[model samples]
Target: MDFYTVLSRYYDLVFQKNKKALSMIKHLVEIDDHTSLLDLGAGTGEEAIDLAFEGYHVIAADLNED
Candidate 1:
């Protein structure tokens, strides 16, 4: 398999629990339906998913397909 394909399978294992940072960011930033977020280096899309759920338009970008 390619490097990203292999890493995708395990990326969540290491970064899933790192979502606490998202909460801090949310508190610091004010986002409404008109606001959009561009998440650079969005690893496994955990934050992107959360932001979408909260109703922000999110663009998740990463070097890896994962």
Candidate 2:
């Protein structure tokens, strides 16, 4: 398995389940329906997934993108 694969599995340990990570990003990203976002280190896609759900055009990225 690659780094992200392992990283994904342990995501909750690295960042807690109720970690306010989403809140932090939600504040930083000023979103519009047409807005585009690139989420680096989008582990397990938590922030990116939330942003997409909020209707922003989100592109989830990782250093492991090969």
Which candidate has the top score in lDDT? Answer: 1
* lDDT to native, each model: 0.81, 0.72
Cα displacement (Å) at residue 40, model 1: 0.9
Error at 64, model 2, angstroms: 3.1
Q: Tell how far residue 29 is off in model 1, in angstroms.
A: 1.7
Q: Report RMSD (Å) for each prediction in the order shown.
A: 1.8, 3.3
Q: Residues 5-30, candidate 2: write the lDDT tens digits.
A: 77766675787543486677677878
Q: Which stretch of 10 consecutive residues in model 1 shows the poorest summed lDDT? A: 13-22
Pairs that collide, model 2: none
Clashing pairs in 1: none
Deviation of model 2 at 20, angstroms: 4.0
Model 1 lDDT tens row, 1-66: 797788888888866745677788688778875788898999988888987887778999998865
Q: 13, model 2: CA deviation in Å? A: 3.1
Which segments of model 2 are wrong by more than 4 Å? Answer: 1-7, 17-21, 24-30
Assess candidate 1 and give its lDDT. Answer: 0.81
